[model samples]
Target: MSLPRYQEYKNSGVAWLGNIPRHWEAVFLKRVIKAIDSGVSVNSIDTPAEENELGVLKTSCVYRGEFDPSENKAVIPEEHDRLACPVRAGTVIVSRMNTPELVGAAGVVRQNIDNLFLPDRLWQVHFKDAVPAYVHYWCQTPIYRAQVQSACAGTSSSMQNLSQDEFRRFVLALPPIREQSAIATFLDRETAKIDGLIAQQEKLIALLAEKRQATISHAITKGLNPAAPMKDSGVAWLGEVPAHWRVGKIQNFAKRESGHTPSRQHPEWWENCTIPWFTLADVWQLRTDNVKFVYETKELVSELGLANSSARLLPAGTVMLSRTASVGYSAIMGCDMATTQDFINWVCKPELTSDFLLYVLRGMRTEFDRLMMGSTHQTIYMPDVAKLMMGLPPIEEQAFIVSFLDTEITRLDALTAEATRGIALLKERRSALISAAVTGKIDVRLS
Candidate 1:
């Protein structure tokens, strides 16, 4: 798959561009661009659907390599005139402000678009000679990105801004117009092939997740033997269970508890904290890698903070379910921890297994979401969760179910991990290929 190289090379006198094709010219962007315009600052926030005439492009609109109309922030009709001229097909756009990793992301509109205004944080330019797609691809190169990143600064840690003056003076390594068109066409074909492969891997990961969920849901609800006798559990969501299994409310099996946060005003309350303070942030950690054990948390509270607040300290193996904001995510505490009110935890009785309760709750995530919606709620209340009914099996059967799931899920996890790695490698190759072709390390003009 190696491509041919140009016959001759010459030094470009730029750090990022050690050498280029002898025929190519390295010049300032200001010399080749007909005009560079920045969008107006529209101090407005409204839903996209509410404004039909036009919307303002969010700084994120061009944050990636492609034009994303969905990232637009809706603006009122009165603000439409703020843009000097509406964006058109084949216009090169760049982000003037973003994190170092994403600053200077550029894309070209592929079609004639209407009713979309640009934000002040973006730059729109028309090339006097070079192709828009060629410049767009240039902006994605590591050398160009590194140059932009070196010039950007931020008032706050989260913000990085590229000034217009610095951008205008930036130099570009350019090919003749005909060569630019050929390179752009070649990249469009090659990257699309790579993107298709990445999409297939993504589909595989999704299918594995679906199969895993179904396996867990069936094992927990239907018991180990499919042919076992069945009986109605009286829970509408859960139709029936094994005849020998018992059905009971969540409260019947465990004691429900909540948590609280200490005031931020008291710095002394949090100083040199030693006790594990669990909050909603732990739910995200669990979602990241399907993390099951909360062996550690992002923050810890001092004994003073815990004593000053209503936070309750619970032992290891307690099952915690989110009840506010991002509801339904659950995790088991791997160690004794104090928590915030965003969660409703369960301390299982000796007769009932904590592993069994955790499975039942995890299986009920979808049901929790459904119930949360039925109540028209942004958060699930404690009373509604307390009433959730689950089918219970003997302690031996509970242990068997957990063991079987652990083995089967681990096997599927391996397959999923392989697919994830495949996607990552494909992405790395795509970036490298683009950088090599656009920077003239390889010649892409031939079929």
Candidate 2:
């Protein structure tokens, strides 16, 4: 997929800029930037009081190379000194503070957005003469990212702060402004086609997930033999089940428990802990495609932290469902682990196995979400969960259902994995195409 090169070439005397088309010039970003400054400093609130008041934009807005007014944090007053800075169409915004990979991510403002203020961690620049879209495309290049990474300074590994002076001096090869605009237009057309293909793959994944859940739900509620005698289960989500099936609240068969966090202020409680303490983030990792078991967590707690708090290490077979944010997500413990109060822990009885309960919870997520629709935050209260009725067959039949689902879902998972890889390759191709075009590796004026 290599593209045609320029008719003639000359070294730019810069390692990143490489050999530019002989007709073009390699210049510092500062040479084309008219004005560059950081945004205002303000405390951000999760949900803004109103949509119209001044809001602070997170670095993520620029990181994605798109302007999403919705990702703002509510700030009462965007001070005129820095916060009230007006944002106009064509302004190039780059994040001053982000992870090393995304620190210098930039995008152009395509429309006149209202009531949005920039944070001190983001920089909005106005080009003296260069096209905003052209500079934005440069920001997407590995060359630009490498320079940003080298200049980034940070005391902690998780965070990175971009050096403004060094970034402004970042070199890029440029063509005439008209050629730049043409190249940008060419990219807009090419990228839209790639994006369409990626979107189609995503929609397919969603459909496959729905089909998988339906299969699990049907099997869990009714025995594999459809001709089996049916009886009223007296539950909305689970309408009718096999006549011989037992129906009751989960608490009837499983021992329900929860965990807690130790006080952060007490060093003695957390300083030297070896216990795996699970958080909501850990639950999310376990929910990733093909992730079935959670053997460990992101953070560990001290023995004192476990003793002082309500945390209790559970056996490997215990099933946990997220009770707070990300409600209804469930996973089984692959090894001994403790969790926070955000989960409802279930120790399965001899009659109800962990695998059966896991599938049941996984299938009934839609019902849990429906029941909790009115709440400001989606959280399934423990009492409501305790009242959830599930139909259960004999232990042998339960094992059969679990085994069938395990094999069926794994087959579907493989197809999904293939589609996911295709999407990734498409995205990489998209980025590479853009990089080649903007760096003079390919001429798009004739595109």
Candidate 3:
């Protein structure tokens, strides 16, 4: 699509912002604004210290365009006296040392607290004459964020930071203060409305998910016979269940087994393995329609041991449960697949349907955590999971439960997806409005 002629002239060649007003001039950030390190470090702040003094601003407290004082830490003792670069109201503080995506998160200091100090990892900018709010919004744009990401340098898990000198070199278009204020006001109102819509959609999605879970849990445990006599299950989360249901160990109806990892150093053994290897990342999505890689049967037989075989492919009806990290997530194997030692595969007995067992496992997710062991990372051992007590019903009733839940939950999922899409469209409209207003494509200035 062709851009308007005016947009063509102002195009700094940055795709996110097509063009600017003909009267405006684009310049390096260093030429327009002064960057200050505000060398007040907050490393030694004592938590138990007096609350009367101004709290230190940590990198985390400044996000987007607001100061979250609730997350601020106490000022360190030695650096308290050196707090000369105290950030006053209207100063824009940008995070210099965060993840690439989070770097350059700009927040405006709209209010002042006594003795407030900015941390070393942040850059405080004082605009020569441009609106601070305008600078904040510009920094948040996609074009500016791309520049910040390119400026970052680091190899570790955490992205390294950019210096004050690097930030000063950032290039952006400048408009008059009157125009800047008009742009800021237009964005403030439009973005708020967009955010409100997104929030409402998010809340609706959460409600739908909750309803879906409750519906499945109710059907699997209580059965379709609503008139059945109910009895107290003795669990607070699960109040009362059908009186006829029998409470017993999960191991009674299913076999609980763990998996193992083959040595990666042996290229000969690892190569051509027909067995499909599964990891934590595989279980990230509830639906198992895709996998990263697969192994050959010959490699599995020649070099893989029984423990490595712990990841042996189970039948299509098998139920898999994550035992670490994102604990308690469960899914029924749509096809045969092997998993890591971090997972426990529950193969249902002939008496129980795998679909019914999947729902049962979902209901028992909380109980699984209660039986977990280990200090740092909680885990459910084979014995702990095998011995889990559960209430079971007749086979015929189990089939009824699965069929009823399948139809109801699908409807709820559809509604949630529609709501999510609506929110996304609203956000797109909000961004387009901001870009148009700032670039003078849509004039917000009153004559």
Identify the leading candidate in terms of TM-score: 1
Q: Tell me the deviation in Å of residue 255 in model 2.
A: 3.6
Score candidate 1 by lDDT: 0.82
Q: What's the true lDDT of residue 320 in model 3?
A: 74
Tens digits of per-residue lDDT, candidate 2, 36-119, equal 866777776777536557778877787566666677777755343446565678888888887767778888888877677778
Query: In model 1, which regions exceed 4 Å deviation?
Result: 43-52, 78-84, 263-272, 373-377
The lDDT-based order of candidates, best leading, equals: 2, 1, 3
Q: What's the distance in Å from true for residue 353, model 1? A: 1.8
The RMSD (Cα, Å) of candidate 2 is: 4.1
Model 1's TM-score against the true structure: 0.92
CA lDDT, candidate 1, residue 143: 79
Model 1 alpha-carbon miss at residue 407, Å: 1.6
lDDT of 3 at 283: 59
lDDT of 3 by residue, 1-447 (tens): 122323435565655555767777677887768546564565555452355765667777676445565556666666577665666777788887787667778877777655566777777778777788877777766667777876775534476687777788887777788888877886787688788888999999899878877787777667788799999877554568899887666778888767666667665656555655567666565432121112222124223533444456666667778887767777776656666787887788877777777777777655766877777887777776666666778888888787787778778878987997998898678767655665556656652
lDDT scores in order: 0.82, 0.83, 0.69
